[model samples]
Target: MSDKGLHKTNQNGVSRRGFLGRTGSILGAMALAGQIAPSQAQAATAGAAAAGPIDNGAHVPALVIGTGYGGSVAALRLAQAGVDVHMIEMGMAWDTPGSDGKIFCNTTTPDYRAYWLRTKTKAPLSNFLGFPIDKAVPRYTGILDAEEMGGIIVYQGRGVGGGSLVNGGMAVTPKRANFGAVLPTVNADEMYDTYYPRANAGLGVSLIDPAWFESVDCYQFSRVGRKHAQRAGFPFVFVPDVYDWDYMKQEAAGTVPKSAVAGEILYGNNAGKKSLQQTYIAQAKATGKVTISPLHKVTSVSPASGGGYTVVIDQINTTGDTVGTKTVVADKVFFAAGSVGTSKLLVRLKATGALPNLNNEIGKGWGDNGNVMCGRANHMWDATGKVQASIPCGGIDNWDAGGAFAEVAPLPTGIETYASFYLSITKNPNRAEFSYNASTGGVELNWQTAWKAPSIAMAKTIFDKINSKEGTIYRTDLFGTNKIWGDHLTYHPLGGAVLDKATDNYGRLHGYTGLYVIDGALIPGNTSVNPFVTITALAERNIEKIIATDM
Candidate 1:
């Protein structure tokens, strides 16, 4: 079997101890943490859930901003090392079900729970069949945040589990050969050998049952995608995902509540998918040393008068109103609020004199992960299934030849439109920077919409060839009138406070004693695939070193 095909099979589940047994004792201890099961994930809120808003002036040994992949990893490792860790999440805990008795809304039918503090939903695919699909909803602190930067709408998950709540559970690890380009300063051997397997196991990453996938009605779209890609001489590969293959099979067999098949990705999946809330965050909470405060946003982090950092937080309501303010101190701070959030905060903090000694590279390397989207109008004879799986299982590997890896995404609109949709990750060299605007007293990213041109051209290399081979054309009505590319948004926002530039090689911010960045911000730009697993693995690597030395 080839290197890329290692995760292509899950005859028995990926073992958490398989790789750790070869590594040192530190990683061996880390490997003991297991992926929370579906039933356990649903019932865990009763036990290791987030505590209510943290009290004013509380002090913690380690404070982690954001509860995403990196933050969850940091909080878990720090707590396991016997450090009292406090995680502040700017979004809701999402433990409570909504009026629909589900924690999340459906992709096709977004409600007030769809967007963060927005009166209307800001879906990625805004148009369908020459008609706009967005509709207004009551303003609430919803799951997804369509943050409008200078030239791109960064679609981020705004809840306790972070992007895990809103993304297709494609838990991918970049091929070994591409590791250097992804993080040049890091040791690839350790990552690929120790951390990647640990992350895959921790995330509960597994391959789809090939036998089941070929027979299931929900994955007929992916099968069709594979056929088209292979026909066009592209390497079609089965991608591992965090969604439970067993639960998904049950969903297909009508034995369990539907999630991926019912189009439950863009919001959140109530079943099957193993989000951070089920994996890392759940483990973090299991350590009694870790406590999370949801609906709390950190505004400032500066050196305290005596020692550590003084943190200012705002507790907000569902309507986005600031309900209370709290001041706390932390001996160490981990900035894991993702790329945009961490970069924005750090840039503003440096500019506004909160952390004046922060290095000039605070928000330097920012990129969109070369995210581009397009759909192909398949022939009526090749009818993609109406019941499409929300989680993409296959991708066309044109990254080596065309600099684009296109995931055959789903357009689960409940009817067959004969459309083959794709979300391509391209190798666009364009990088943006985030800077604080003094006039507006806000942070801004200097990313022009034109920066996506290289991405579109790279994506075209794959789709254009596939179109020619299949006698199909690009769908014009999906993004907008005559629009072939969805270049206005990015679901994978990366870089900013980049590793080896904005921070040390291991993510320690320069000029600060205990400030660290352990999130996607540490990755300069792209990771060649869905970046969560990389982020989680990097966090695991970094925190292990910190716990070994700093602690």
Candidate 2:
């Protein structure tokens, strides 16, 4: 078979000794370090499950909405401080395996299990050679949710892990200088020295073993990406990830079930990736002071006449039906439902008189993190390898001059497509505002599809350079035939209820004593990298202060 076809098939000549030699030692070390065992993890979850549902006007001391990085951190820290915390999630629990014995559907074969409430799949790379590449899928509550707004498609994860369930696992911390600029009011010294490190450790962020990366078949695409970037006079940096290196090595060696190598990210990683569900959420459950209610979507948050918040939630079923409406009275409420989710809820509440005192900055200062995805048509000699891994390990950092950090993303089509794709986080200063629509009883984001022009222009500063150096041209087939950039969507939506403006410096809402705005909503606009690590560190910093004083 050709090399392209060879890579499509499973690696041959695997042996038990070879597998154990590479992975066993690493697993042993991890186990020796008192990592939570499977049974212990299950026991912790059972303890949290033992807490009964908070339906029918049940009251709790603290209620966290959404289970993303911010909510997970808040829940864990609050629980660890001996506070009873309850989390409400709109997504389903992803721990249980389906009838196919998998927690998520692979990217190579998307089905009803790949999307959330969509009849048709909406992949980031939507087409090839003028032909639509996405297929029809059943309308079900899947993992990745492509929520449509007025002018942009927001991609978010839906499950216990939230964005962690569907993201690329690229746990990137912004440069200290850039981070300080992003959030000027935040104490840079405290964030860089304390919270960033703390968040990295809590999230299990680690660099790829350089030696292993050099030899791994799955990383050949990244190496090619590095080569082109360096040749074009750009710096290629190794980006840290939340994936376990030992497990990835085992997957490449064909000694274990594959996740990253088997095209697992974007939907979910069935193994190896250390999502928030496995870390903070699990630890919170172990405290036995935190209980999570999945499939519970918080609709409104209004002040109760009794000096607390009244939260109305809809219990959704597997088929996306709102089966029941429930109420919870909480002393505190945290808006951690991500940038879009939180912004939508807040804008509606402010306009509908539920939270009339909310500041005018409720849904202002929103941005797409300057997200732009593009692809380059490389020569046949620049083969990006057929064995491309889904979890990206490196990126081209032209942020200093070009205002863009471009990840050498994988085109894990299970075949050699002879294309190089990149997802760039640029420094686009364009901001959108979410306004309440009185007619539709919904929120509208006043961001035109054309607003992505600046982001696309910023990204071209890097790709255009490389393309010129390599004598290559942009690929129109990847995103859509004749379409050079996928700029109508954002995977990293930041801002809306920004820190210090919409809330206090510590994430507390201006008018509400007990309400907080955590998650990506606190970011002013852009993080210049993947927003999760920054979101996490900011949460760590804010929650630490909140626990010490507010609680």
Candidate 3:
């Protein structure tokens, strides 16, 4: 899909001639045309023609603030709806490989491997992913600060794809009831039935390597959890992942690298998972109605007359160096920055009177998964040092497991036939208080940890249940041996700007005409498992709505 007018292609994907034939309407095409090197001949040629109205000019110019899960999906649907969507990404446009601030590898072609080589961010995108806090980039885009969380590790990716480039790509839709828990007011049947599947198709969600869980080595860990749960009398289960199994099979066949074989995930699995960059954003660009400008950070957003806005952005250079400042107007604006990022931005805007007409629910109902962590004992042997050898079997709906409960699908390292033990836990309302530090112009999260006690208690109970039921199939080795059960850290932080009728249900600012917020921040409350699929689904749901009605 070149940037030209709607070039009707015989095939499915991008068509060259049709697109390039309509490049006259493109904005600043000549500027980028020459800037692109010969290597980007196709992209450059397509960019020339990738501009024009697709239909009845029904499309309005929309500014999707971030290219993360939500904004990226929004851009795609909006473009499909014939809306002119200008995707504003605050990070680098990963045309090269490396971390946020550093480049490491170079790409040889235009495949996923080549794309990965072009981008430098790593998955398990935690604080460790960037430079140390003291030397870290001044801007606060969701980069983790290991030192700040008592040396806890949390990862976040930057660049055009956002975290999608660095995520494990394990898309698991939360249980229907889980949705029932977080967002009580939203219609679930339509969401799970209509929106969920739509998001799945868009994100390429599916179960991969189902038999892998049954591997002699994999179930070993589940046994360990069983024993621990028995001892304390708790329940646990398995959940499916959204990974593409066919890709993994090819990878395991040696046609691909081991990176696809359950390895390289925590650091940046090069194998099978699909990120937002590869799927939705790329697809959106193909529509020609969507244009993403990366390496530019948003400075502010002001409402424009007739349901539009003016966005101030700081253009950043290829080297992550600030180049200049510019402002772009949009017929509609969306705040898809993740929870911490979006809430901070909105909280500041609300407090500073920038959005003086904001609602009271701007930053309320703040809660994470009531995250709690603990280890179970398996006295059969020593622990394996593998970062993530096995994924979770699923989760438990004990009605006692916080809002939910689940355990890792145990996998034994080939070296140790004994069942591998795990330390997993979650809570119902691991709340965080969003207090505006007026002088600093930033949002401070003072966590209101009410679920702490219940989380820890549930962890212990689950461990006891596993032990009494499954028995010790293996010995245990804790990550931090110094601590006991239920003593790990949380990475699945959720809910800063919760969703409800108060916020217009779909995350539109209650009183605002065109401003919308999408991201993890809009999570109804919390999910028992990782929230990527849920997040992306909600984004898919909302973005489609925006395209159908608002845009």
TM-score of the candidate numbered 3?
0.73
Candidate 2, clashing residue pairs? none
Candidate 1, pairs of clashing residues: none
Model 2 scores a C-alpha lDDT of: 0.79
Worst 10 residues of 3 by lDDT: 20-29
**Clash count in backbone of candidate 2:** 0
> What are the lDDT figures for the candidates, one per model?
0.81, 0.79, 0.50
Alpha-carbon runs more than 4 Å astray in model 3: 1-60, 98-155, 216-238, 305-307, 317-321, 381-404, 407-427, 448-451, 468-481, 485-489
For every model shown, the clashing-pair count is: 0, 0, 70
Candidate 1 structure quality by residue, lDDT tens digits, 227-303 = 99889988888888877777778778887788777866777777777778777877888888888888889999999
Quick one: best lDDT, which candidate?
1
- Candidate 1 stretches with Cα past 4 Å from truth are 5-49
Estimate, for each residue in 21-116, the C-alpha lDDT of model 3 and write its tens digit: 000000000000001122243322222212321221133478777888888888888888878787766654534322221121111111212121
Clashes of 1: 0
Q: Give the poorly placed runs of model 2, Cα more than 4 Å off.
A: 1-52
Q: Is candidate 2 or candidate 3 better by TM-score?
A: 2
Query: All predictions: root-mean-square deviation over Cα?
Result: 7.3, 8.7, 10.9
Can you write out model 2's per-residue Cα lDDT over 1-551, one digit (the tens) per residue?
Answer: 01121011111211111111100000000000111112334323322323445677799999999999999999999999989999998877766555466666667677655777887778777776567767777666777888888889898888777888878878787776676778999988888778877888888777788898897888888888989999998888888777777788889989888877876776777778778877788789999999888778999999999988999999876668887899889999999999999989998998999999889999999999988888888899988887778888788887878788898888876767678888899999899999987887888889888998888888999999899999999988766668898887888989999999999999999888899998999997799888898999999999999999988
